[model samples]
Target chain A: MKFFINKENLLFAIQSVQRAVSQKSPLPILTGIKFSCEEDKLVLSATDFEISVRCAVPATVEESGSLVIPARYITEFARRLPDSIIEFEAGPDSTMAVIRYGDSEFNINGYDASEFPSFVIPEEEFSFKLDADLFKEIIKQVTFAVSTEESRPVFTGVFFEIVAGRLTIVATDTFRLALRHTAINEETPELINVIVPGKTLNELARTADPKSIVEVIIGKTHAAFITGEIQIIARLIPGKFPSYRQVIPNQFISEIKIPLKDFLESAERVALLAGENNLLVSLYIRENHVVLNMRSETGWIREEIKSEVNGDKLEISFNVRYLCDVLRSINYEQLVVRFTGPLTPALIIPEDNKDYLSILVPARLSRE
Target chain B: MKFFINKENLLFAIQSVQRAVSQKSPLPILTGIKFSCEEDKLVLSATDFEISVRCAVPATVEESGSLVIPARYITEFARRLPDSIIEFEAGPDSTMAVIRYGDSEFNINGYDASEFPSFVIPEEEFSFKLDADLFKEIIKQVTFAVSTEESRPVFTGVFFEIVAGRLTIVATDTFRLALRHTAINEETPELINVIVPGKTLNELARTADPKSIVEVIIGKTHAAFITGEIQIIARLIPGKFPSYRQVIPNQFISEIKIPLKDFLESAERVALLAGENNLLVSLYIRENHVVLNMRSETGWIREEIKSEVNGDKLEISFNVRYLCDVLRSINYEQLVVRFTGPLTPALIIPEDNKDYLSILVPARLSRE
Candidate 1:
């Protein structure tokens, strides 16, 4: 099989599909990215059972066929190939591929494409479409809270559901939880709930352009996200996601509205004295200011930031990293933090935006 | 001890001296940075036995004294402190340092200053001065060829020698060598030869400003580099340095000039197919162009680059990384390479510069 393609387009397609290729996969075929040239298009694909991605780029095809080449070699070759159209051809045995650009040529080994596993979107799956930017942003807001541990597989994914009429996504690692939803303007008659692995959402958000609309399809055990000419199909995380709403506090004794920038900088400075590996920082709320106190065996640092306060004064301690993550993800100038007590979970929200909410558990630091 | 110092100046001093603080030193005192506060200046210092750095920043001392504080905490506090002057004070036991900036304060633990070991400059040492930029540049050109293995301590250092009144520096891993020297115009009445460890030169280059002339003092076992208010004294590597000039060919049978940019780009691309650990690439020199051929069990890549050839067609193989290193380190448009058959070493030199020269030993490819 022979085809000539633009160097930039080929590299883009190879990188997009190679994201799903597992470099350390036990199966040799899983390390290969399948390349198929048909008529006027070249389709590149890779899968590791958990997730599969396929991207098709326009190319001139004098002879059309398919082969599976090592993902690492193909990416490196495309990266180093001269800035020009490249003549790529595969031998009849589908074991060797040659790439020529300018006067440079690379002959790389590959495997027969017949043995490669491919994912197919279920015909009976339910389908819905959302603006790519909206989907990517929502994923970014919630995915950071997902558990990275594999033992608790359900918490390792972001829970997706149709709550009321809006599409909602929620993630939690037991200690902290994040929930973000699209505008309630869109109506959905059918109730849909699926837990997608956080990795799949991150990969999709990283590759897909935020301008276009993305079509999403869900089945019993798999989900597919389609954007433009690229499609990503991932296995739905098994097991039931926890009911996080119950854990989030419904009432708060005190609410303080602080400038996000001021609070973020003060928190960062104070957290430096909280020791390595530990990010414990205390928040003391008063009438006109909130004090951040962090200490370890080596030192203690306290910083105060002015804010608008309501209700009784309270004090709470939390992992400073969690608060920093929430503050950095949102672009709001002001943030409202509500505290029920020193031990209970605190709720943080953007003052101008109501769609995003984060709950952080208080840490227990010994005063002794 | 108590003092008030500019936060930026103190931070710079701490950062510069902290490089010599050993994070994994068996002796706990070596991990601490010694701070001596006089009437008008505060001296901060750290040492790892192999190398020591002392830097002084202007400070107003309310009480004159000295103490040793943990390097990590001091650097961190200084980094996060406000931009204004910082009020610093040590407790009566000289074991705790307190720093206050604006409304924020940090209390850090430390050790007694009397117990900390500090290096004293020898009065009998000989001193010399050299342009910092020229010395830093010469170190950069030759240090990359130094052997990193501690087994051969001398090979892991760049030999500084006075050859025919010129300051010559040489380094080699035995397989290859790089020698760089200043113009042979400056006359040195006293002959000096010393070997400085690669790490010491690297740290000095990284921290020392290249604009000033550096004062270098050579003692029996230590060499001190004094630039501005910062001084770095390192234990010189002691052993016989191999005569590298003998290995460098004085005469060549053939010479070829190639565009550095073109040759560098082609070498990097072809080296991609040279396997993970081995970066050997063969250069086939003909009348008009040099073809780079690199191969592994999985694949092979051949790239051709045009050059002005004065030699007959010859084929030689060498580690492409060595060639790339020389090409990237020097900002030369054209480089002249002299080859004596395939087995002997090849000399690479910048067309317009006589200050740098690098030699590469040919690799024995299996096809031999």
Candidate 2:
């Protein structure tokens, strides 16, 4: 393909699609980025058979053609090029392309465009639009709880449930769960649910433009996220997601309200004494204060913070990492934590917002 | 021991001495930092058998004693503590210490201070003081050429030669050499030469305070760098450093001056196409311009930058990484490169500075 484009534009387009390039595929062409130059724009596409990304940038086209270039070389070359117009022209065989800027040029070998795998998004059954920032926030709130264990494939993704105009997203790793609720602009005729791989959700969040709107389309086996000039298609995880609603406790024997910053900082300090792998810390819920305690082979730490507590006093232990994750994810001045018993999971929510919550299961205190 | 110190002061003291704690030493006590509370100051010391560091901070000391605490725990605890006066007290047996701040406390287990390795700086044979910023800058300019190959232990250190008031430092891996010279205020009566381990120099640079003066003392078997409230003592490498003066050519047949920005950028871009391990790139010096070329298995790249060439046409090849290192390290607007022949080494010097220079041996061109 023959085209001329600004260096910054080319760099941005490559970055958006580079993550989808296969690292160690048996088919070499799968490791390349397919470049297609049309009348007024150049489109770049890459896929690893699991997720595909496509990005387009405006350019001056001299001829309409296509080629698949090695991702690494093109990326580094584009990053080092001067901030000026870059001229790209393919040879007659279309296997070699020359990139020129000022007096410098790079003759790069590429693969035949016909050999690249075609990326096709299946027909969508439900579609809706959401603000890109809101979508990113929703992903951030839930994806951390997604299970990294591959044995239970269904738990490795974030569950998305849509009923009417409200969208509920949840992720659980059997021990902890994160749930968030938001309202999308579009309403669907019927209830729609899908499980998206957590990795794809993270990539989508990273590439989402805060000022733009994201169109999310869900199909039987695939889902697509289209933003301003980029589109990401991810394969939906096929399996029945566990019912997370049953995991959250509805009643609590003790409820405590504490300043978010004080509680988070205390937990972080007490966690320093926790075992590296177990990360277990005990919390004693009293009438006027909460005490956090952890013991390692070398030492033990105890931290106490003031809190407004009600009901019977209780002591519970948890993997402090989970507590820290939810504590950092929520942006609030204070948090309300509810506990049914020492062994039951605890519910933590922002005091001012009811649409978001996180549940963490308590671990058995080893010292006891 | 009992003392009270501000959280920030304790954190700074821990940071300065933590680097000397051994990660996997045979003596477990070496992995801990020795804290000594005396009169009105708390001193922290740590050693890994090769290097030792000590830092002191002001504190309100009620009792005078010492203990060795694990480095990792103290570092993390200090980082998480509130920004207020922290109370520290040792138990009766001195095997454990309690750190209290606000209503929180940490009981940390530690070793007996008697078991800790004592760090001692021997009587200095010669000493001199240099500006901390200038010393750090000199280290940075020469340390990059230090050999990483453990087989050649002598080359793994930077050679320091002091004659009169002039101090010269040289480091080389046999393929490239970086040399720098500066004059110190204090001159010794006799010539003093020593080879300091590159790793020690790097740590010294990292810990040096820019606004303070660094007093460098050379003893029989050790060297000490003292700046502000921190002191680092390192064992000198025992070996005869090679005479590097012969490696640098006395004269050159071809000298070309080029803008540092253009030359550096072109080399960086061309280096992308060079072999991953060899990093080979060819430079063709013409009458008015220089062309940089590199060929990979997949493709080739060529870049031409204008230059002021006063020598006959010549072609030479070099490992682009060495070129890029000196280019990035030197702060200059233009560089004068002198070449003796296609197979000899080349000299690169900043246009405005004469106290620093780099010698890079050329590689054989594979294509020709």
Candidate 3:
């Protein structure tokens, strides 16, 4: 294969596909990026069995051929090449590939392109285009709560549910759950439910441009996200996700409003004194003031912030890290803490918006 | 003990001393920072047996007392506290310390002050003052060559040799050596040779301001650096250092000048294709052009650049990483590579200065 392309354009395409390359794989071919020059474009594809990324760059195709080269070496070489056009040509016997840029030439050993696994791209059947910025925001607000533990594979992904014109994203790790609601511009369709791995979603969020619209196509076993000239296909986790709506508290006997930044700062301060593995938080409500206390045999910290309380004074304890994560993921100016008795899980939501809610299970406080 | 001080000032002092704190130490007291509050100053000190740092912050001390608090907790707390005046008060029994800032209060369990190790500062000793920026620059340039292997404890640090009117710093890892030369204003009757730990020097570099002047005091067993209100003392490694001067070649048969950035970029590009862990570089010099070839059974990369060569055509091979490090550390625009033969060690120096040189031993090339 022989082709000439801009260094930056080729580098970007290689990097976009490199995210799916696996360092530890049974097949050595999986460690390479397949490069094919056909017609008028150069195509780059990388996969690790579970997910695959393919991107095409405009190029002057001198001859149409294919070869698989080491992903990391090519990526680094392309990145360091001076701003100039890069040329690639297959060597004799197709055992080596030569890359030339400016006065520099890199001859890298190549793997048989026939050994590379082929991934089929799902046809654009039921597709929806959404604003990349808004989609990224929704993912950021809910992906952090996804469970990383692989024991329950279903919980390791975010549950996407679409009914009528509204779309909801929910993630739960048993200790805490995050739910975000949004509206889609597409017409009402049959209810759709799928669990997409949080890691793949995060990569998509990073690669997607905030200003561009991302086209998403869902299939039986995989989902495809097309942004600009890049396309990413991720396999759906096949399992049953827990019903998170049932766990959210529907009633609250006590509620308090506190500034978001103030609460976040105080939580971070108190968390420093807590143990590394687990952090305990004790909340005491008295009159119009709320006292947040965290203590360990190592140290103790107390923060008192004035809040608008509208119920009987109560005291509750929970994991401080869970509360902190929820507060940090939120972009609201003020947050409301709704409690349903001392032992029930508490709900945290933006004071002005009810579209997003975070539920934290309270810890059993020992009698002092 | 009771005192109040600006949060920013206290945080800075705590951060400086915390650099000496080690999480994994046999002595528990080494992990805690000793606080001594007297009259109008609060002193914070931390030591890891090998190195110690102490700094004093201006404060309104109500009474005089001292205690040891966990360094990590205090540093983290101070970093997160709001920008305001912080109040510090020790318990009547002196077993707990209270830190208050705005509406937040932290009560950290304290250790007995008597358990904290005491460090003595040398009086009426040899002292020299130098620009912090220049000292830091010299350290940055040579310290990267320090031996990380613990087999030779003395080689794990940089040797600082001070003569009548000059200061020379040298570091080597057996494979490569870097030397930096700088002039000192004061003349001394006695020559000084001290080997300071690379880790400690790195910490000192981080805390030292580039624009300020730093006072250096060399003692019998320890070296002290004073900058602003902070004093850092490091225990010298006592042993005979390798004769680095004898290893550097005094004469060479061939010398080539090349742009530092171009050489670095080309070396890095070829090195990426070299085998992991073992990076070998082969240089082929012609009448006016130099070609660098590096290949592993796994990959192959070759780059050619034009240069001005002074001797007959020569070929040499060496560890690519060593050359890359030296080229990266050079601050000059251009560098000259001087060598005796293909197997002999090569010297890399700034094109305009001969005082600073990096010597790299050649590596045996594998048969193709």
Per-model CA lDDT versus the true structure: 0.85, 0.91, 0.86
Q: Which candidate is the best by DockQ?
A: 2
Instruction: Place model 3 in a CAPRI quality band.
Output: medium
- lDDT tens string, model 3, A99-166? 88767788888788888888687754466778999889888898889999999999999888878877
Best model number under TM-score: 2
- Where does the lowest 10-residue lDDT sum fall in candidate 2 chain A? A269-278
Which ten-residue region of model 3 chain A has the weakest summed lDDT? A119-128
Candidate with more favorable, higher DockQ: 2 or 3: 2
Instruction: Score every model by TM-score.
Output: 0.91, 0.96, 0.95
For model 2, which pairs clash? Answer: none
**What is the lDDT for B78 in model 3?**
80
Each candidate's B-chain TM-score, in sequence, is 0.95, 0.96, 0.95
Ranking by lDDT: 2, 3, 1
Q: Candidate 1: where is the Cα deviation over 4 Å?
A: A119-134, A184-186, A210-215, A274-280, B5-7, B39-42, B58-61, B82-85, B119-133, B163-165, B184-186, B210-215, B276-279
Off by over 4 Å in 2: B276-278
Candidate 2, which CAPRI tier?
Answer: medium
